[model samples]
Target: MAPLLLLGLLGLLGLWVLLRARTPAPGWPPGPRPLPLIGNLHLLRVSQQERSLMELSEQYGPVFTVHMGLQKTVVLTGYEAVREALVGTGQRLADRPPIAIFQLIQGGRAWGQAGSPWPTKPCRSSGAWWTSWSSTELFNIYPRLGALLQLHQPVLRKIEEVRAILRTLLEARRPPAPGPGPVHSYVDALLQQGQGGDPDGLFGEDNVVACVLDMVMAGTETTSATLQWAALLMGRHPHVQGRVQEELDRVLGPGRPPRPEDQRSLPYTNAVLHEVQRFITLLPHVPRCTAADTRLGGYLLPKGTPVVPLLSSVLLDKTQWETPHQFNPGHFLDAQGHFVKREAFLPFSAGRRVCVGESLARTELFLLFAGLLYRFRLLPPPGLSPGGLDTRPAPAFTMRPPAQVLCAVPRPRTLACSLKTDGPSPGP
Candidate 1:
């Protein structure tokens, strides 16, 4: 009986090893070999995540796989691969990976032990009372109070005012600041959402604050970085820069501020913006997760597999763009000089989880960009050559130009025109 039992145990062990060997491992479509355990994590962390991924795609073919921890992340590179993965089977790719950091910080009460104690004493005297107001109820009271204060409101002022009130209410809910006064600005927006009956109700105040912090960290860094790159690119190519300025001059005139509507008539300006988005490719990779067991490129992707969509690969794919490496506005323009939107141009990403603040980001970019361009002509500082404009991008959490500053000489019209008027009047 003992001998029989030993034989059976050995047989079971052999079967397990056989199954492990037979199960195909996930990997890049076809490229450089991976090291054990660590897999491609080292490659990604070292190789300048976006650009290195693009180069790897050039060798390995689009739709490769990399592993982050025990999880396999299938990377979709190039326009076709990204489009098929995102737009074609978009629903499948909509869910984001449960990033450990996000889960820890944003997961709320579910994160820790069920019986975690709460303070018996109030964190603050009025904190409990302030926490009860819904965002809607707060907004209702704010306008009447503002009217009583005799504040003159402008268009969109209501939204701004509501945001301000929400911020204050949120701040009041928190414990008193440590040393100095509390920080203000958008952080308040998060606090408001938390205290205000979950304006979206998806999260509590802590989660709201975490989400807002994520947005601030993600949104501000990426947009500012892209703008810096755009400036560098424009400085590098004077003719392109001149064309943009000429378009601004024609559509907006020398004296007036550019409005959102003017974007329609300013094709060149629009094209430049598009090309800037393409060139910099702010977020080269967007991380997603498989909702269920699936097959991609003949490889079995188990449910909950992490996926990294290489956005820069699509932007820089040689097959998609005529001058993939060059700064070219023509990528977004037609023979008639009209702005041509392309499926490949996905700087803001695509699908359900696409950047939530895309519209706001675009508006801010257009306003800030047009505002600056209208007011001044950016030039290489005196004694500095135009060629000296640093095109080298410093990869951080986002891609941005190297530390360098250019002179923004006020345009003649900017100097002459009053802030109230569009520009200086034409002489008789």
Candidate 2:
């Protein structure tokens, strides 16, 4: 009994030492005290994670530490802090943090807590907890536990299935011979790279498929979500919508599709598009890691520290805009009514890890929005006024507009029959 008691005491001592070792890193920025094992996870209760972080920033300043699992994350808020960390010293903070869902998809090594079983009660409770929360918070929180469940393997298999599908498409698109083929598609360029016998194997079959998948996934989802928000916002702001449509009608008319060059002529429309991105702030925070110990906002962020640069804070920073809280297209427009880019306009994030698909996304937004608005007059649902429409976005990987109906009345002057809506069209 004496020996057993001694061993038990030794085990408890070891546990205490382990927990102490995992405390917030030395000289890390200030934050609410983190509990052992769970860290500050329990304290992160806000529906919109960005808002919660913003509130914490109000107390902790622009930079602060929040423990996510055993990991220490430094959250950077506002344009000044975000710019200093992401742009001023980009290379030092360019590494992508190892997220569990991404790791499962990337087929990287499972994280330390990858297989830790979640209690059935907490699983259900956590789901219920976030049902009213924004997708951003839910998305970030769910993935933290997603890999722990039995469902993870199936998710991995699904990712493999997707890769297989991509491979099949690559096989179909491959030229009969590698040399002198037109770089007809993104896949073709990747295939051509593989043939070039690059020493880095940058264009290997898996790499090519992964690249295509990344482009397709990143390019499609966020762009589609942004366009959805644009349509919804337009419906909520008929006057703004009318102005955009007027510009589109004047520049391209209904006879022709909107070309990329047409954006130069459609200044108001361009401003609206930029405002949509800024207003929606699709991605509230982008996850990053420090490649080396770095100083940001007078805080010492250690090497390998996970960093969340809050893009939403910058977009909504009062100092950066005339009406940061309001959905004002004038934010992107000069007194001359020309489209002007703001230094604080960072919806795509900035620095070394700036979104690779920024140009593609911009092109997609301008063309799709101009075409849609030019051919349709967006209106709120029957009995719903634009003022009644909820601007609070649903939290997700991107900021999703709330579930509500919009009326897309076809423009009588539209020459394109495809866009000429017979009646109100349902929106996502």
Candidate 3:
């Protein structure tokens, strides 16, 4: 009887192994084979996530499948595939995938004893406990004077200082002011809603803080990285750099600061900025999930399938942009030097999840780029050729230019004084 039971158990084990080895449904997107249980999660390295995914797509074609743990992820590469999946299908892929980390943070479930003390207090009622958890005191104050305060610290410290400034500014600007103080800012708009009693009931202090944090995170890092890349690229391609300066000089004179309104007149400068965004493609891929069962390219994707929209592919796809790999501003400009917007240029992403800070980012990029170029001509460090400018990026949560320094030599001195100044410069 024992020998018969052992034989039956062995047969069941064999059947389970056979089922595990069975192929995935036919006509699913082509992809590297996933291992049992671990799937392709182990295959992805943190540092090389973007490059590895790009390589996989190159081998597996524009649209491919990858499994992350038990979850299936569809990678959409190339401009057409990405556009069709993201824009054409629209919100079908708008929802963020249910990742463990996101769920924990956003699920709003409080863990721990329900009616216990704050560790120091006596037992509290359930109502009190719930009120404490939902209290507005949990939210941090917003910083509004971020532009006025200056911090001499590391980047992270500077960011915190800036936030404090923003909070102060917001506080000062609130209520009893002349007409409406600037509603230009996202925070200002939210604060306005809150003051007006928020008919939607969503404009709480927590939401305001989160929204500000989101704006800062999205606006600062990506724009800074892109500007860094632009500086490096300009240093490498001196001719392009020269063209940008020439355009600036011709339109906005050397002595004056470039204004936001000047962007329309400075077409070449605008084109260069656009090219920088396209070439760098900082965010790379924006992850989304299917809201319901849907067919993509004739494949039935089950509801909740993770979709990765590869923005880098859209920016660098050979079929979409001329000289996609090369640093070319002409990609964004016509022969007449008009700024040409491309549908393929989607660094801010698309649909509902499109970057909320696009306007702010664009303004910062233009203002900073124009400001820096106007002040100094970026050159390769002494004794180094343009090729010495590091184009290789150290990819993190965002793609960043490798650490390297460049010489910022002031452009040839012209006038010693202008506007309020008494006299013109003495010629050298």
Residue by residue across 1-428, what tens digits does model 2's lDDT show? 99999999999976995678466466888988876555676667543678888889999999998876456788999989999888899589888776655665555633221121111111224553433433223334556454454435544555676788898999998878757678877778889878756788767786677677676566666887788888888877889987887777777765888999988898899888899898888878878888998988887777888899999999999889989888899988888898897999999888998877788889988888988877787776668788887777654445666666667777874232221111111211
Q: What is the per-residue lDDT of model 1 for residues 191-306, given as tens digits with 9 covering 90 to 100?
A: 44345365566556445544444554566666776677766666677788788888888777756898888888888888888899888776677677778765666556677777
lDDT of 3 by residue, 309-398 (tens): 888888888888989888889999888879998998999887666776688789989999998888778777768899876777564446
Cα lDDT listed for each candidate? 0.61, 0.73, 0.67
Name model 2 segments beyond 4 Å from true.
1-25, 109-148, 196-202, 388-390, 413-428
What are the models' TM-scores?
Answer: 0.69, 0.83, 0.73
Poorest lDDT segment (10 consecutive residues) of candidate 1: 113-122
- Sorted on lDDT, best first, the list reads 2, 3, 1
Ranking of candidates on TM-score, top first:
2, 3, 1
**RMSD to true structure for each model, in Å:** 16.6, 5.9, 13.9
Predicted model with the maximum TM-score: 2
